[model samples]
Target: MSGILAGKRILVTGVITDASIGFHVAKFAQEEGAEVILTGFGRLSLVERIAKRLPKPAPVIELDVQNQEQLDGLEGKIREYLGDDASLDGVVHSIAFGPQGAFNFLEASWEDVSTAVHVSAYSLKSLTTACLPLMEERGGSVVGLTFDAQFAWPKYDWMGVAKAALESTSRYLARDLGAKNIRCNLIAAGPVKSMAARSIPGFEELADVWKHRAPIGWELSDAEPAARGVVGLLSDWFPKTTGEIVHVDGGVHMMGA
Candidate 1:
């Protein structure tokens, strides 16, 4: 192992299956020499089972970002898992979800829209703050995933908006945490066929576009490429970079017509 992340302790969220981008990140992080912990979103048992499949067994803890109590007690829980002296070297926020109503543009109510933003966007701040105590002293990196929200992707209405907000939130976090030496960035990935993607109604809008436009082309079934980008950002290679969106969309973002 090159051990690019040797001696680093990282937190990875949103792993429901081996196909999840978080799964890939955790897998690669381990292969590259990092001790990782995972957050279970309302299903610790399922996540625990999945964690066993990783290169090394990682501890999975319950964490629903919307729950204030869980967020508040995260540090102590993590410390208990990683040890008192364990200071996180990086965090991967692959968490994002939108209620069904929010998938429709005009049909989405403020209630639905807010839920999307809160889960997909606001959680970035919430999750990061939960780890701030462990991160602030030694400083680390925070990396999240996003489906490019620049345009109105069909059936991806409110969720798209939430991602844009997520992008902005990373920038603000980078600005504020820079002095503390904490870097914040995001990976704007192409359409991936993860468990989350299967839940979305019209995810094909992206797959269709990628097939017709992407210069380098994209493989919806393959998340390792995008996953690699996130792990790289979590490593020491991107020490001086923050607030940037690393696009892993196979040149699709660069094409207009």
Candidate 2:
């Protein structure tokens, strides 16, 4: 328990597979001496299985950011494992989704767009608020994952817009929550070939950008760099940093065309 996250408790969401950034974040958090709890959306069993691969045993909690009931009951569920007065030192939001229609921006409907925004963007707010009570007294870090939404990418479409909203939401959360000593920040990572990437239409075309532009080079398979960024933000090392977007994309976000 001598690591940077020693004695801390962190809640990680959207862990569907070992290849996911969320999974790695959970793994690293535990390795750094933090107690990690995970939340799964649709496939609880799959998430539970993945959680077993972490450095230490982590309890899996069922959570759907869009589910009002689940959001309202999140603290209680977390308490079930950590006890009635359980507190969280950090929360990782690696959740995002968009219907197939969203990939075709022009043809996408409000239903598709709404679902994309709701789950990908709004959930940041909802999830953070849901965890507020646990963090209010002592304050903690809220780290979320984001693809660089500053530019449009092939097939990213509406999901890009949702990420934009997510980025903005983090800023406002930081602005409001800073008074409570809580920090909200995001890691804008490069693409990885995880289960979530497979869902994106023409994902390679998107990843291809990193291939040519990332000044330091990019690895579509390596998630450790990004996971480390999350752990860094969660630690006391960033005591004065909030509402920031740290790019862990091989410096791709900075390369100019």
Candidate 3:
């Protein structure tokens, strides 16, 4: 059968490795017929190596979300990559980083905590807004990856605060962009054993909690479903949905743990 996202042009970030959730999103988006673009931090060669694995190879663009100059150049960069006439159909804000300090709350420094907020939270606003010019031409969806914003988790610490801020930021973006028929939403995903998750001090402990607490049961290292949720939201199906937080945590957020 055919797919839902044919011919759509989408940009996805935060793919550090094949284990990263962003990788699955890019893989599936291409399978569903979308033209995928990728943004990478640190090393371009690493991203270039991984790019060969996607359904259709994508160009690796350098875009450290925290870099103002890089952010400012995004629209032009994208246009240059996709040609001037091809406007963006969707954007994935699957970007975040916090260092070790952000995971220990009481032990975390202001510098580290602030870094968490800037990279994990504020960068979403930066990225989405940078892509706004392309999206505005015909309306589009902005999907961000998030964790539960309702409560703090043990060892999740400052990253939790950043997530809360991210959720609020997404809603604000949705509100501002609604007039243009653009949508902004988040996928509050379960813990997956990605490179980013490995940075957390007690990720295994948190994963154990999910394995037990989630009614449907959650996996420590599964990202496929989360990727599917992102692709679906990016598609044309959820036209009226904006400022929404869709929990893809295997029903864990619903029950008391």
> lDDT winner among the candidates?
2
lDDT of 2 by residue, 32-149 (tens): 9999999998889999888888887689999989899999999999999999989999999999999999999899999999999999999999999999999999999999999999
Cα-based lDDT for every prediction: 0.92, 0.94, 0.90
Whole-model lDDT, model 3: 0.90
- TM-scores, all models, native as reference: 0.98, 0.99, 0.97
Candidate with the greatest TM-score versus the true structure: 2
lDDT of 1 by residue, 1-257 (tens): 45888889999999998889999999999999999999998767989999999999999989999999999999999999988987999999999989899988888999989988999999999999899999988899999999997888877888999999999999999999999999999999999998899879888875788898899989999989998999999999988999999999999988986
lDDT of 3 by residue, 107-183 (tens): 88999999999999999889988998888879999999999978978888899999999999999999999998899
Q: What is the Å distance of residue 141 in model 3 from its true position?
A: 0.2
Name the lDDT of candidate 2. Answer: 0.94
Spell out the clash pairs found in candidate 2: none
Comparison by lDDT, 1 against 3, better one = 1
Q: Judged by lDDT against the true structure, how good is candidate 1?
A: 0.92
